[model samples]
Target: MKKTIAGVDIPDGVMAQAATDLIRGTESELMFHHALRAFLFAALTGYRENLTFDAQLLYVGAMFHNVGLNAKYERSPYRFEVDGANAARDFLRRHGVAEREIEEVWVGIALHTTPGIPEHLSALVALISAGVQMDVRGARYDEFTAHQRDEIVQAYPRESGFKKKLIEAYAHGMEHRPETTFGTVNADVLDRWDPNYRRLNFCGLVLGSDWPN
Candidate 1:
């Protein structure tokens, strides 16, 4: 039976179910629900915008977008976004998904945290970011109806203090690889949570370069 919410049918294909099970088993309850909600929100956004997308691909992207935050990747030198993207790539490959489709999911996950560019990409890529931003940053909140909002939350309640806790999760994921946060939004997480965290300034690097201006 396919679960439908907000006029969207949740993908339940074998690959989709396998991907869901993987995340549900590995992620914390809060994060697992967050991933599901992100998928619903993204699907609804695609419908509203009249964009065509592969719901399965979007589901995979949503489910794995934050997986890198798990303690397993704490020592990785890559940005959490890239780690999550690479994880998605490996999973899709194991399932025998084609390289082209896998790359779409990879870009969707990798760029979800980027501030301004995902929306300009393919519908699949754009909706992943849309769903994540809608859930976390409340981006485009007014675009969805109250009914849509109410049902998604009722289906997957946001844990208390989601905003603060999400920030803490981000901080925890990146604090061990502070160098990776440079030039990305994860730096904001460290700024808020990691005491003694010093942000790298791009201009400072340019000016300090051996090539004198």
Candidate 2:
């Protein structure tokens, strides 16, 4: 079924349908809801900010941004972000989308987990980062008026079990590939859940270096 959020419509179509179907079929219910919410939240961000972007591209990014955590790519050696990005890129390529647009969506999904960078790349990338953050951490949450947020969430209800389920999915996806999680937000998951995980600290570099000063 098609849906709308903050006035932007997400129709079931070439760019969105296949990826949506795959995730819905393979991932958990919480994950599927989260993907839909990511698109709505990102679209809401773009709508509220009057940001110009390819809605189809943004939807593609949102729909497949977490493919890494799905059973299809969960065990990939790359970060789940990269896995998701590759999935989006391939999907776009198969549909004869231009190389440039495919790259845009790819980078957006791959870098969505890296903070402070995507917002500066371009509109689609920025929106993808913002949308993922909006879904996960409520970044820039104040922009959405209460009514808007209610409408989006109501359209795709975030079940009470989402937080824990999403977290577990991330951890399980990257548990065997912990190296991929380093330097991205996924690191935090490993830091908390995977017992054998170790977090990197740059302070060691500063302390170990001999300062000429």
Candidate 3:
């Protein structure tokens, strides 16, 4: 049966499990935790208004954005972004997702690592994913230090009550951007040895713990 969270129906259990497995292979509990956190955050923020196609697409995209990490780590290691996207595309296809949705998913996975994509749901997911990555690394984006956040605010500044609603919805999640930590490490040190360690570490911050369960 499909699992629903915050009103989004996740269609395939097998694919979900596959995604879980891929994230788990990172061996970083923190990475897994923050990844899920980002997904939840995306779902909550993206669905604030009517669930448009773009928003729905982003919700799914955020869920499986990092599904390629393990495979990427095994392959080139440094190019986890590319590897993870390819792996996610394959996994999505294997799980019987439609071609068009798969393409959207691919685009989301690919651009999540890079900035300057279009300002659609994929781009939004990419930005939020980046924020989540920052969280995993024990970093925070305050009003002053958040250049990207400032850009986003400028691009979508509150001009009207409706815009305020939208920004409020986004802010509800974005406001919880993680803070720095020096006392404790959440994931195993061995997991940090991968060539994609930096990326995975950031991801770990976003994902938190409680993944692959």
Candidate 4:
């Protein structure tokens, strides 16, 4: 049966079900629930903002946004966000979804970790970012009513010490390719967890470039 939470109907189509199965099999219980909560929160934000979005696409984006954190991608060269985005792209393509919608999901997942950029891109991207921030950092917490918040959390409870676990997940995913964290918030996770992590300075890179000044 399809479940509705916070006035949003969870997408239960074959693609949606397949996406749920993929994430359920790939991620931990905590991460799987986090993805589900992210979807619910994104849908709720779409309603409050009067923004129309494809629920299925948003669900897929949310489900695959963190899949890069899995052990399989530990050696991936790209940023974990891009890895997740590419995974979504491949999945959507195999499902015969349109190219435009696939790109929308790609951008949404790719920029999910980028704080300010995704919100300005598109309704799909903005909602994904908003949902992630709201779930992880309590951004826009007051926008949702107390009852709404309680209901969503009740449906997908945040595990104990979710913040720490999430940080560890980020660290574990990106630790191998520390260079990918440059110029994004993901760097902060490595700095905290990996003692060998040395953050690249943007200004230093700019001035140290091989250009005749």
- lDDT of candidates 1 onward, in order: 0.92, 0.83, 0.46, 0.93
TM-score of 4: 0.97
TM value for model 3:
0.48
TM-score of every candidate relative to the true structure: 0.97, 0.90, 0.48, 0.97
Quality of model 3 by C-alpha lDDT: 0.46
Better of 2 and 4 by TM-score: 4
Candidate 4 residue lDDT tens string, 63-111? 9999888999977999999989999999999999999999999999999
Candidate 4, 23: how far from true, in Å?
0.4
Looking at model 3, which ten-residue stretch has the lowest summed lDDT?
178-187
Candidate 1 is scored at a TM of 0.97
Ranking by lDDT: 4, 1, 2, 3
Residues 14-96 of candidate 1: C-alpha lDDT, one tens digit per residue: 99999988998999888998999999999999998899988898999999999999999977988889999999999999999
Once model 2 is optimally superposed onto the true structure by TM-score, how far is the C-alpha of residue 136 displaced, in angstroms? Answer: 0.4
Q: Mark the regions of model 3 whose C-alpha exceeds 4 Å error after superposition.
A: 1-12, 53-60, 67-78, 121-213
